[model samples]
Target: MNKWLYRLKHAWAVILGKAKISYVKKGGFSFRDFTYSENEIQFLNSLKIEFLFSEFGEQRVNGGGADFQDKRTRLDPSLTSLRKYFPNAKYTVYSDFDLKIDGVNLIKVNSPVAHPEHPRYGYRTADYFKFLSLTESDADFKCVLDSDMAIVSSDVIALIHLTRKFGFCVPYNDRQLLRQDMIWSQDTQPIEDESLGLGHSYNQSPMTLWKDDERGNVFYKKCAEIMKKDPSRSSLVMWKTAWETGIYPYILPKQWCLCDGNEGLGEEVILHVGHEKIKEYYDQ
Candidate 1:
């Protein structure tokens, strides 16, 4: 994408300002909107589902702050919400410190994947551990969301159905245009034969969903195999894998990745709090 064209697209987006998911910003996240049949819920529950979350206790927020590792708390509430909604789903946690949450699979990584000394901040700031679910597990379905996510009130059952129907289910970059470089670098892309670039789904990998079968993980295993070329390009690995598998991504409603930057547009099912902006919960 040319720099000028990208800017023009962004300018048009701001001018149009249309987002699909709307946050019920007055009182609370009304679960009333979730109206599914028992059979539908049962069918969803029957499938093996896994949610991946990571919080490095020792990992500092790139720059200095009063509460550097404050995002650790982000997992508890988000996990609670997920459990309340999707009780049959399995949860996985990857952290450097000891976390004693019941029914949640845990992995101990010796260190955060962040490399602050490196020139590229993507390696330092990217949620690299989240990709572990893709590499380490073989559940029927897998999910990994961003740390900034304050609330996930989306229709989980429907999204699961969509994942089964489609290949990768994820949200769009509604607030801003994510650069192409973040998805794939020209020099370090791992796929030998194909380019790892996506046109329809922007910032889709951060809040993504996919599935595997008895055969094994189709997308992630490929990424793990080629990650050695440059592990820093996590999203690049995913894009490459998706491209090769022909399992293109399904772009969810833009509001799933909504933030303060795009409030008042409509109701939001998934809200990502910057922690730097509101420094609090989704108190609506």
Candidate 2:
């Protein structure tokens, strides 16, 4: 809360106000993602935006395991789309071993948590890098994007707008009903605060938009504490922590930021390549 920092935030607030960004909400629904003025892109590009991605198991490529067999194939296209939105933005990849992707900065860190015995990919333990990068990032706006996805026009700007609007942005969970409190609690809900809200989103996709500010730091610090004890067994941690911290995210509608579990992927969406099952969804 330094005076200069506070003033700087205030100054940005005023500049944003002057930017005259208009939100053209799809279907006129308040909760849905909106299309912004094209002029806003320049201003958005001027900000310090960074895209975070992780490839924990390079060996997954050679394996027959479906969990991440084709994940590496998705990285390049995703990067190309990300670069389109934020032409001068930073791209960071958190990996377990040495990796070189053109125009990407790498942080070779091993998985901090071991996967619990699960027949499935044990995704909870595998996504620790998603938490690690977002928590440690110093960008003005940080986006946690799955390597399998591509960014369409204005999607990046929309995410940043939501983070600034509601303190954070996460895609709406289509299967939110499956997120029983007992189910999540049995899995060891990280920051236990009974007074806070629960199940605002249960998508468990690592995709997110975070602004580097006071509330953002609190959210990251809470995740850091969870990492020490829990260490990203699932994206449920991100969804739950956002609510518990009172930084209830703006739900980027089902059509935009589309993923697996979100069915009926017609030709009316913004982002479609998110889950390992995305290929099947595309085939259908």
Candidate 3:
């Protein structure tokens, strides 16, 4: 199909409040069938879901005059809220230091790149570790949740179901540059200009989901290549590569993972509190 026609069909589906699933043949492989309704929840209860969180035990302090504690201040409460919403779901924490959460598994792993000499050293190391955890974890399906985020809705099962169908999902953030020019169409291709660095648009990775299947394996391998090219900017590279390669299909509905940007948390399931504006909103 022509790219414009594909966009038009998707526009029609959106106008009718219906979901559109498109299959494109590339490298002799075609995407399988998957469907999603606006508010429909399905196939969540039977999935073996696990949540992964990465914290580097840094001493970054917030405006509250206290150390930005990952365990005592952030992860503890975040885990409590997550368990309350998802009682049967398993939890794992990836960190350089040892941690103890009652029912959560702790895995200590070191960063692949020594960041002392990099330009943006110490920036997004935890983000890189989050990607590493995907390869380290044994779960069939994995959802990476930042330590600062809190689960606010019991309907998170809906997100799990969406991930199972879509293969991967990321929350929509208010960053205009990240969202613009990111639509996946037949003609969409990855940017090869190294000078572009992070490229024009990408997913907000504060909270994301991944499956352990073939698609997930390919996605992670690409991410690893990006990290090898530039360790300090792995997060940006992952999104850029995904968009350019058209490997990851779609972004989850905004209601699934809400960020602390311009968008209000009107029916959002997960509340991401990593931004300064959100911290101010919660008076933290």
Candidate 4:
């Protein structure tokens, strides 16, 4: 399986680089299909920080979907709200509608490639890479957060401070039951990319910080090779590689980074509310 996936990753990367493949949506999360509760939108408005809302997919005029069809409809409320927060912060969104979002600049591409690393079919490191490209002129540092997040006043500053002080920031979460063993051997559970060399921060969503010193283009290209080999093990492989390569300096005991999985600390600013855990948090 790893070998097959590796071959696929290699093929995906090559095809992506050369502009060879077409990005077609199979079933997955689409932001346009999601509705932002007023509370979530209001919370985002309260943050009072300049941020961009990244949206992918066609704009849905009125929400409707075909039954038994994978076709997704558009919802622009998030983008609508994002405009409120970062009005002058280069407001725009991208879609394989025929271009790639590389940070602030949108580049037209012939082929719409899938970034297997991200859960979203169209979202890629390239988009954030594009965001980082704008760092020189405006922001001292940029923090990437997911649209689903409900950003409050504290998060805007806390995330900024974390990245500024630590040189890195991860979601405020903790370790979960590793559904498999941390150390991988074929006899043990299948080992993945973490062994190949990558960062353990893959699980951190909505807020990944890449400094000017770290070139996301180079890092993601190298990491994609490992992800192709084993999609499931990609996170571990990326972490293992990052540690071995020393791409980013470490700050740990793992506690200071705010592991939000098992424990919730009072001071933790951002609330993740991932797709799986959204119901749990929403119900509460």
Report, for every candidate in turn, its global Cα lDDT versus the true structure. 0.53, 0.56, 0.57, 0.36
Angstrom error of the Cα, residue 239, model 4: value is: 1.4
lDDT score, residue 74, model 1?
39
lDDT of 4 by residue, 109-157 (tens): 3223334545533443333322332342244444444444333222233
Pairs of colliding residues, candidate 1: 21-267, 22-266, 22-267, 22-268, 23-267, 23-268
Worst 10 residues of 2 by lDDT: 27-36
* Per-prediction TM-score: 0.65, 0.66, 0.67, 0.46
Residue 113 alpha-carbon offset, candidate 3, angstroms: 1.8
What local lDDT score does residue 242 receive in model 3, on the 0 to 100 scale? Answer: 71
How many clashes (backbone atoms < 3 Å, residues ≥3 apart in a chain or on different chains) does model 2 have?
Answer: 1
- RMSD in angstroms, candidate 4? 17.4
Q: Ranking by lDDT, best first? A: 3, 2, 1, 4
Candidate 1 lands at a TM-score of 0.65
**Candidate 1 vs candidate 3, TM-score winner:** 3
Task: Name the best candidate (by TM-score).
Answer: 3
The per-residue C-alpha lDDT of model 2 at residue 262 equals 57
Task: Tell me the tens digit of each residue's lDDT in model 3 across 35-83.
Answer: 3344332344555668888777545433213234544644754677677
Worst 10 residues of 3 by lDDT: 178-187
Residue 56 local lDDT, model 3: 72
Ranking by TM-score: 3, 2, 1, 4
